[model samples]
Target: MVISGPRGTKDMLPESSCRWHYVEQMVRDLCRLYAYQEIRTPIFEHTELFLRGIGETTDVVSKEMYTFTDKGKRSITLRPENTASVVRSFLENKLYAEPQPVKLYYMGPMFRYDRPQAGRLRQFHQFGIEAIGAAGPTIDAEIILLATDFFQKLGLNELTLLINSVGCPQCRPIYRDKLQAFLHDKLDGLCEDCQSRFERNPMRILDCKNENCQTLSHGAPHMTECLCDECQGQFLGLQTLLQAAGITFTLDPRLVRGLDYYTKTAFEIQYPPLGAQSAICGGGRYDGLVEECGGQPTPGIGFAIGLERVLLALEKQQLLPDFKTGIDVYIAPIGDKGKTLAFQLLHQLRRSGLSCDMDMMNRSIKAQLKRANKYPARYVIIIGDEEVDQEKVMVKNMDSGEQCMLALQDVQSMIAGEMDN
Candidate 1:
């Protein structure tokens, strides 16, 4: 039987890879502009990291993680998300001692054992950024602005920015109690997962996707109503700063993100065209994550954008850039002497930074031209015994059908010049 890629994983063909490259370049350029240095971590880590950092009650740790015991009798897991690993890196490397706020970004594949869908995959890529040790509301506004700037630059204008504050540890306990009291009577109506979360983490019920759960929790207490003085001040300050930066956002009281570590600020950027799973980017402040990961107390905030989902949105909206898929020149030789000259010229053109290819099969001039056309080379260089003897070649502009005879050495310069035009 022929082998195939795992389910929920995709093989990116050349055409699809071009789009990936374009998006990746844009992300790198944006990260550079924002002064977020790139950080790469291992694909897997100790299983306890996610449980402690992401919380045992979270879906990622409780249900979705790809975890197993290795030969060393140690439990290891492929990261379903990167924030936990990033926090571990920040602590293990002592990045805290070097700077007050460490700004970092990462791009790579993340794994999870999930049921496949349009935008969600078991193995997917994410472009994410984290600003650690930053405690002010200004940084929160900056992070939100960064997300908006990326979508706008990509010509994705139909995005809605939803912001909320899921009160910090100081006030969250009181809100959790109020929320539990409100939800106690509706326990039977909630989903089984949410019913269990009632006593453990009632706040997560607000983030449930089940229609029945959403409907039952609608009238339950909102975190905003129970926010303490400090959280309220931070939320108001974030709104003011966001307005001053001309970033529009809607206050969503039910937007308690599906992460345990998120505190104070939680925001998600949504593209409405993608039904059901509309969030393309989501993140917020986790002031206590560093401490949870065994590092000193550090205030941090970050966001992750699913690259596959972003690509899907871009393609759906017809916003992807037109990418060239052909080589610069195809060298077609008609005779033995022409073949030798063409082979030498092929390498020369390539060394000069031109994308050039030559026919390996000994085919007739007619067949060679056909292959050249199929290659869709911008220019075709035809070599024959006569041209080889004269040390000149016939270069045809494939698109315009304009043929010109030039010195073998001049072919490279001519193609470069034409490309500029």
Candidate 2:
């Protein structure tokens, strides 16, 4: 019997890994340009952290989280999302004590027991940024701009940027009442999830993806209509700043974040061509998350991008880069003496910044050359008994079918120069 890999987890083979590397490189470069430092937290944390920070009613905590008891009899969970963990890190490290707004970014695998699909997986990766300790609408604008700029940089310009204000604690009650009143009669029509949410968090019903639920939730009161003075101003200010920055967006009254902590300025960017699961990135400001997590009240905003979905979008748009695969040079040796010298030259070439591969099996020179072409080596260095005796090797350019004799010591310099061309 052949044992198979785990479910909902796909191996990142080399070809896919190359593309992932390119995407990650761009992430690091952009983070540097934005002056946002990188932070990495444990892949798992105390289950209570997310339970308190993400809210008990949220799907992440209630349904999807991978929770279990450790040997110590403490409940631990694999992080389904990162914002709550990032906040916990911020508080534990006393980052707020040093800075007013702490800007940080992270990239790593997150676990969620979700049904595997084209771009959705139980074990998926996310690239996120959390700008903590800032309350100004400008910070909100910056977060949005940064996300859009990253997509644009990756040649993903055909995106729908949707923005909304979920309102704050002061005014949310007003909207919640109106929404509940509107949904009171439609409770039986909504999905079971939306029905349960009506009492605990009616606002979340607006975010339901079920068509029937969406229909029931439509025409329900919008948070924007009942925003408090401060929330209203910040929302309007964010719009103005976004316009000044030349980023156009649609106002979605129903755009509530999936997370319970999101207070204001909820937004999601979608690649319409991706069909229903079009959201490649989404996030918003969570002003009360710090206080909810036992830290002093602090305002924060951030976003997380689903990397697999981003890759899917890139594939759909034909924007993925063509990554070349092959070694720089392959060294094939002949006889015992030639093999000894070939091994020495292989290390020498590699030390000089050349990707060189040599024959490990004591195969015939003809067989070695065949395998060399499989690596599709750009250049092949053949060292025979004659050449080894003369302290020289025969070099062949695989592309141009050119051959020449070069001193063994000059192999590194020649290959390095040829690569530069």
Candidate 3:
């Protein structure tokens, strides 16, 4: 029987992988410009870390985690999201001691157990960043700017920036009470999930996607309307900073993120044409996550972009960038002596920083030429027994169908010249 890969998983083949490489490089280059370094964490972690960091009441911990017990009877889970693990790394690695606020970025696969959809998968990749130990609206605005700049870099200009304030520990309780009281008589109208959320987290009811829950949530007290003095100032300051930065946004009162750790400023960016699943990315200030993860109280904010969804949006907009899928050089060897000489030249060209490939199948000259064109090599170096005896090789340019004769010693220089262009 033939075995197939699991559902909700995808393979990045050669053609598709080149685009991934381009996207990854763009992320690294852009983050470098913003003075943010990269960080990588383990694929899985102790289950309690997420349980404590992300609230137990949230859907991630309650339903979607890929968790199992090990031989030592310790429960472990594949990371559904990375913010909590990053906080753990911050505390454990003592990143907080070095700087006031450490700026970092990451790109990797994340696992979650959920029903697969168009752009969402059980296994997906994310590009995210975090700014820790800084509390205030300036960093918050900068985060928004970085996210927009990245999208703009990818030619994603048709986007909606939605912002809101979820209040802090001090004032959320009051609004939670008001929200619960407001939702009290309307409990029966909520979905099963929203009904359960009412007892543990009433604010999440506003974020529910169910149409019935949405109607029942209409005219409900918004968190922006109930912000305390400090939260009020920070929210206003964030708006002012964004406006000063020339970034336009809309205030979305019902934009409560799914995570329980989020506090204060919350935001999301969406491609309006995609409709219900329009959000390309979302994040917010989790000022309380560090403390919740056993560190001295630190303020933090960041966002994670779902790469698959971003690619989907790019496809919809016809904005995906073109990628070159060919090597720099292809070597075709004629006979025993030529094969030996070809190996030496291939190593030399590669060591000098040129992408080089050679025919291993020992096909006829005509077949070798065909294979070289498949990689669509920019330059093909042919070393036949006669050419080896003459101490010369034929260099063919695949694009313009141009050919030139070069001495054996000048082959590397010829390919190096091609690289400069």
Give lDDT per model, in order: 0.91, 0.91, 0.91
Query: What range of 10 consecutive residues in model 1 has the weakest lDDT sum?
Result: 196-205
The runs of at least 3 residues in candidate 1 whose Cα sits more than 4 Å from the true structure, single-residue gaps closed, are: 188-193, 207-218, 417-421
Candidate 2 achieves a global lDDT of 0.91
The runs of at least 3 residues in candidate 3 whose Cα sits more than 4 Å from the true structure, single-residue gaps closed, are 209-212, 274-276, 335-337, 400-404, 414-421
Local accuracy of candidate 1 as per-residue lDDT tens digits, 81-166: 99999999999999998776899999999998989999989999999989999898988988888888888889999899999999
lDDT of 2 by residue, 1-421 (tens): 9988777888999999998999999999999988899999999999999999999877888899999999999999999999999999999999988766899999999999877788888899999999999998999999899899999999997899999999998999888888888998999999998788889888778889899998877777788989999999999999999999999999988877878899888999998888777899999999999999999899999999999999999988899988978888899998888989898888988887788899999889899889888888999999998998899999999999898999877877887787788
TM per candidate comes to: 0.94, 0.95, 0.93
Candidate 3 residue pairs that clash:
none
Model 1, position 362, has a per-residue lDDT of: 90
Q: How many residue pairs clash in each candidate?
A: 0, 0, 0
Predicted candidate 3 versus true structure: per-residue lDDT over 1-421, tens digit per residue: 9988888999999878877887888899999999999999999999999999988978889999999999999999999999999999999999998877899999999998999888879999999999998989999999999999999998888899999999999999999999999999999989999899898878889989899999999999999989999999999999999999999999999888889899999999998777666888899999999999988989999999988888888888888777776898999998888999899989988998889999899888789889989877888888998889998889988898898889988888877776688
Candidate 1's displacement at residue 103, Å, is 0.7
Sort the predicted structures by TM-score, highest score first. Answer: 2, 1, 3
